[model samples]
Target: MAFSTITNLDAAAAQQHSHELLDRILSTASSTYVTGPVGQGNGERVLVLGGTGYIGRALVPELARRGYRPAVLSRSAEVKNEAEYADAEVIVGDATKAADVAAAVKAAPTAVVISLLSGRKPNDVEDCRQVDHEAVVHGIKAAVANDVQQFIHISDYGVYRPELIPQVYKIQVEGELIGQHHGYVPWTIIRPTAYFPYLSVAFGDVKNGLKYRIYDHGEWNVVNPIAREDLAEFIVNQVLNDDAIGRILPVGGPWNADNTVTLKQAGEFMFELNGKTPDWEVITMASWDKKIARLGRLSKLTKQLKPVVFYLEAAKY
Candidate 1:
């Protein structure tokens, strides 16, 4: 079960599981049974790790528009200057590299560190661990070294214990950080559910035979979505809200899973928006497509994991 109790767990496994569950609980907002509201932000300098991905692209503009300054951490020039952080400072740095991470952190001594990087590739779990898990450890160290008052990490809603949903990656990032890093600065963590923007496209393609999807069946878990502006709003809040420190916050909306509909349904909505007939079909979660071959499932996994399945278990929204 998710977060059964610590007494029943051994150290290492417990550490990993606890870390995961904490992340889930926060992202899913099980405490309030709410997805999460974008934070009430404070205008301040922020170091955004993994600020080149989809969420980052959507989030950076909000950071700038809302009065908070965002600095991006990128190892690739392509990912760095891809119109994502046009308004913010772009720093060439790797989150996992201690020196690079420290240099970036030191550049803005008073800023908060927000981690958005983690294992995203199939063959890159370890790499993700190195950057997401270990590099975060380094960031905390840097935060303390730089005397920053806050460390805000962008975590996921998926990490938690198995069994109740062991198929999921079930483990909390918060636990991993505190247990492993012992951050010296006041810290804040943001855990949000899947994003609606990408899901609209991914699911539409999959159901159209453009791709195969992955799913075991049923909707045991739910999708928690926050708009890019909402995410940015949360970041702004994190920067300004001094009381939010040392807390893990999850943000979502009044409508979560209910708002999360089937691909076909979503497609119809899109078609209506396009002033056309919705011609998409609902692909079986386990359906297979030959064009992308197994890669179809891989692509679907990214979307499914984004809102549905992880480690093969359903999300407990």
Candidate 2:
């Protein structure tokens, strides 16, 4: 009977089952569950790594508005004069360096440290390792050494099925925190789905009469991409809260007609927004898979083909 059940499981069912099992394991091994909010921040200093990017612009201000002292670590001092960072104390440091991360943590009495660090180049493996995996390890070590109350890591939801290089690194960082590989610091791992900008990348092309490329019927998966502002609010809500400690929260926007959509549906909506007939450049999954396989072989000989393969893999993801 067990063998029969295992054989009958479909791909989607297997994926869902895997996620359920992983969640149960993490929850049991991490911390005991607690209910209710633990009140507001009382002037706790929050050191935000990677706070000069898209989500950071919204999160820093939100943290300040909620009575938390927001300190942003940026490589550039010019951000200090930026209006978005007006409420934040800008600390000049590079996230890729362990010493810089440690100094930034010890520079002030940091109560919480949030790592929003991700690689800018998803196509580069070395960059992903340095920024996504190694940089986060730096923050984890710093947070532990400084005795920070909480370490919140913003991971990708796609780590559940890590097909891309960046996703693999995100998974590794998640493991380091959950296993206490570096040291013991109360941690919250948030796996957020695609952002609005990511899903809307093709909007401009579609508006300009370019065919929106998609695989198979583009109905393979459905996602509800969240806005940066909404995601920032959610992240702040988890800050310094006992209920959120040692939790793996998979977050997205509201599940409604407007938000929840398949890739094909997303493309159709873009066409409607631009008042144009939908012109899709649909490619079969079998052919796309073959192309990826061919490129995978070529990447071994030519390093330039690596990024091309990465992009193809990411699109399939």
Candidate 3:
């Protein structure tokens, strides 16, 4: 069964709630495909779009260890020499092009196709549409034409309540998949929370005695960022599984003090870990809004400031 965990309760209560919820889910969960561990791969091929990324490095090897034949569709042939991709066959291709995606699917008789594709720039609307929405649609169409058994999409938790340009495209892709916009295809959608790296972006700065920046109060939002390895396992678990078909799973890391924290708490932890007193530069939302407005005006004159606007809006979110 598919489910999402909410971490809106107090720290202690949230931890206990997560534990109880997980226990209940495990006790009741059932899968239609349970013939063998990792099911019988039988050398069945699985095509992965965006397989040169951070999560793909972990996911490709896991699929190999589990007996599935992983085929990575990458734009760079250099991935062929990477140790992580050694276990899988690398098909050089650009996912943004429909013909390239179709050729990758047709290269072998594939059973499953998974997409971990997203734009490099979140603020660029055109880039987001091309990579996040159109590219994924290309993969989906390819999978449909090839009669692929399953198509799994790695979406973001932000799409649950979309505000950003990237998230908007992600939501659109989800709608197309669920509504059979192209053709009938069994699909699974995963909405994972933030990754640990995103949360630790300022750790080095804090260690260097830079004042930690935060919005007013900094307790407006809380997140539990999952590790790449953990997220990879979660995604692989759904591959070729009948129960996972047409399901949307929202997952996160454990709800401990270190894993679950607000923006303010994240900053405090960094300072404490670096053996320094908390030095926070809190910006009032009103002041931040003014800056964002200025950036918005500047973005129209040049493309460089679009990312700045996105980052500001994302922080406020």
Candidate 4:
């Protein structure tokens, strides 16, 4: 009888130990479910504006993977690829339209609203203003009306110093977005440097046998380009973290503080990605200035290229 009692006690201890081990393994495997103060778990509804764009396409999937339900608002009824958002709810509507924005916001009482809208071109100042500034204002009003808890606005790092003519639109929009949030709801603004895809323009001339153009020998300015997927992950992870509320976060790629890429380095990286040699041409500031001046004052191409010239010229600083 004494032996049987001891054996039963030992089996009970062994079962408890095994259960604890399983618990630890499950906790480690389910890291994404670990919620912060703002996180309401996987059932939280998130509304994403401009969800059909480059960044949004990645962001929606990342949100879904993290167990948050995401609903995307697009101007078109038919998404280019339906399977991409199989888990997300797709609402067809134009953000610029007040009614459409309201309908999407009210579609579900969202815990967070993220805006990834951007202008298609640098020279289209009116379109830029409308989409980046006005549409955001409208979206904010809609979110506010629906009692959304948080708002995340994606802005460019170039807006920090608006010396370029095209940056004015971004500057204005950033001001409106921050001003409108005004303590009513928690707002987080993310300013990201140029994305890797944006700098891939160097590849455009590569196939034509044209040497990649480098300004000031591509050594003056440095940029830390972030991958779109990484940026999307950062944004979605911050959604429910109250610590990120009202913070202006500047993010970069996985490079050390002292490690940054210049235009030449970026071009070389792209060339190497395509398994080709880095052929380069250096364009001096003086040569670029002369070319711009020769384009004449009333030329549309010149107007469109002003932002490019401004960026290259500013890089020398």
Candidate 5:
């Protein structure tokens, strides 16, 4: 039996091509070994939402490497060019729209549906809610409708104690996702600590010849930030390990004292990586408070600053 790749198709063509791809994958009589919660099996079709995003880009290829044919749903046209998706089937569609999501879900008899969707913009809370919460809800419904055996969700550790308003939406979405996982279908929620790439935001100031900014006197705060590739491997492994089912795993970087690094240390490391010396300034609590007060509750700056504030607060505990 021979296999083929599908690309750059319209909605109708994409749906038809998806079915053909699934039929080809499922028709294979030979069983390939797979890891994680779904156990070793044949004819396992995995559907990935947000497969074009950071973790998804790594995960789709990882799934393909593990002998599972992963079909990634994306809303972008550039998915055709992404080298990471070369091994997997790419479906162009919106996860937020029921018709689009249903089409993807119905494309194959999916054994597992993994959602890596999140808001791309930091300041847009509404868009975050739409993608993180509403679109996730849509994906869940579609999975249930299609009899998907297991669902794996990529959530943030910030959902543990959601203090910031933006984080509350994520928490809410987590609840809704878990609540919807009833009957025979089980769910696994992975709440990973900060990604190493997220720390690159501090580099923005450096680009303007400004010193790296730290909150609260640059005191060392231990945070275990995982690499996106490592996290992708962990997520895929969950699909083979039944122990992960019906559990919310709070995963960090490798278990080591070195895995934990303060933001100041992280900044210094970033500087060293860029072949520069560390030059950082501290934003005292008093200064932060004054800035917050001046911006007022309704200010866009306030919303933008809240995550930084929350991170500082979290570092203390």
Candidate 6:
């Protein structure tokens, strides 16, 4: 069975949705394989696209621990964090391009492919489409060509509720991943809600003499949050387990998100963590624009990045 909770979808929709779930598992005939070589070397081999990012840094090592030979598709020749790079063989290439993906496939045959790349910025929207949307299709195509059996797509907060984004990208990623490609490769589409580790850092900065600001009233229910370590562990566990194939695991951590914790409690946590009290103010839609003005200055953020913090301010997360 696929890992998705979207079981209510009709037949046509179910299979399409299920394809994303299938990519999550390790479906080889044997659950356990010998460490060295079990006659023919059928152990799972994985291709981790975008192995240098935060999630990738955490994931590749876990994948390695599972006995999967995880090779990385690095856009650059050398990875900045060599410790993360140590767990996997690095294949230098641009995942957004077919040629580069083809090279990655050539380097790792019958590999399960996982992409950590996402479109994080406005300028990178085109690139995100190229990487997140198109590259996924092409990567699966390449995997199928190479007889690779599994594909995993990790969609970030930006794909869903990005702080300042226009909000059309969710449909873009979902539509692209769901269209065609059945019978191509077993797949998993993971849409994790807001991330907490990064938030810890962002909020930490705000508490540490770093001025904090919000978008509107930090109103909407704070989104689901999963720790970086937990997410890595889930992906690793799923990738090597066949039962997880054809599943879309929508994972979130417990109490990782809750507005129930009042501002006083949140403030205390942040202040304690950072050793400095934060500058804060509750806002409303009427004052949203004005807040952004003062906020941009207070955050000491750049023109392209003010939205990230402002968005966080609105979050009770």
Listed in order, each prediction's TM-score against the native is: 0.65, 0.84, 0.82, 0.75, 0.76, 0.68
- Clash pairs (backbone) in predicted model 4: none
Residue 186 local lDDT, model 4: 70
Clashes per model (N, Cα, C within 3 A): 28, 0, 0, 0, 8, 14
lDDT of 3 by residue, 1-317 (tens): 11122212354554455456545444663432222234446678999998888788888988898889999999888999999998899998899999999999999899999999988777677788899999999999999999999999999998877777778888889999999999999999999888845546689889888888876676656667788887888788889889899999887876555466677788888898899999999887767777877887898899888778777776654
> Best candidate per TM-score, number?
2
lDDT: worst 10-residue window of model 4: 1-10
lDDT of 2 by residue, 1-317 (tens): 00000112244554455446544544554332333223467899999998998889988998988889999999999999999899888989899999999999999899999999988877778898899999999999999999999999999998887767888898889998999999999999999888856655689898889998876566666676888887888889899889899999988876555666667788999999999999999887767767877998898899999888777766665
How much is the lDDT of residue 109 in candidate 1? 51
Give the Å error, residue 2, model 2.
Answer: 29
CA deviation > 4 Å runs, candidate 1: 1-43, 77-82, 122-124, 160-172, 196-221, 256-258, 262-264, 267-317
How many residue pairs clash in model 2?
Answer: 0
Q: Supply the TM-score for candidate 5.
A: 0.76
Show the lowest summed lDDT stretch of 10 residues, model 2: 1-10
Model 3, C-alpha of 209: deviation from truth (Å): 4.8
Candidate 1 lDDT, 1-317, residue by residue in tens:
12221122233443355446435555684343422344433567778777787678867777777677788888776664566667888888777788998898888655677766655542333444576567777777888789876777776654433232221221445765555446567777777765655555655664554532322222223344666666766666667567787677767643433454433344455555555654543333323222223443565557543222222222111
**Residue 19 CA displacement from its true place in model 4, Å:** 57
Instruction: Write down the worst ten-residue block by lDDT for model 6.
Output: 1-10
Give the per-residue lDDT digits (tens) of candidate 5, residues 176-231: 76676433457898998888555666676665566887765453245667878778
Candidate 2 segments whose C-alpha is farther than 4 A from its true place: 1-39
For candidate 3, the 10 contiguous residues with the lowest summed lDDT are: 1-10
Best by lDDT: 2
Query: RMSD to native for every prediction?
Result: 10.0, 7.3, 6.6, 18.8, 16.1, 11.7
